[model samples]
Target: MTSVAEWYEKNLMLHRFWSVDDSQVHTEYSSLRSIVVSNFEETIKMPINEPAVGKRKSQIQEYVDYYSGAGV
Candidate 1:
């Protein structure tokens, strides 16, 4: 996620005071390596994910499990 962090840092001005859109953040069934990102204001949405291998689970799988379990 280093690239994401770097991009966020570089574009901090554009995302000023933005908040996560819990309802829209989810994984698509068609592709496990995909993530949907949205803001609380619903002004913007984006998909960010990459193929990665984990010890026992993929990164996207872990994220889906966490958010789903947390009821987000």
Candidate 2:
């Protein structure tokens, strides 16, 4: 999870459109970890997200808007 977040932080172009709050990322990661740990048998193979508050629009929200919904 940490590595994935780090890679996104360094390489994702989404940042160009919206600023990601680092504190939000940390909180999201912690929450995600707790969820994953609690459901060890269930594997999450696709992106699951909610629009996170930030300085600008949320990247996740932008994707949902562009696509009109979530995808697998």
Candidate 2 per-residue C-alpha lDDT over 1-72 given as tens digits, one digit per residue, 9 for 90 to 100 = 345434544664222222233453644323112011112233322233455555565566677689998543
Off by over 4 Å in 1: 12-40, 54-72
The collision pairs in model 2 are: none
Model 1 C-alpha lDDT per residue in residues 1-72, reported as the tens digit of each score: 336634654674223233333233334432223344455564765555543443355555667577774122
The true-versus-predicted C-alpha distance at residue 4 of model 2, in Å, is 22
State, as a TM-score between 0 and 1, how close model 2 is to the true structure. Answer: 0.36
Highest lDDT, which number? Answer: 1
Model 1 worst lDDT run, 10 consecutive residues: 13-22
Q: lDDT values of the candidates?
A: 0.45, 0.41
lDDT of 2 at 27: 46
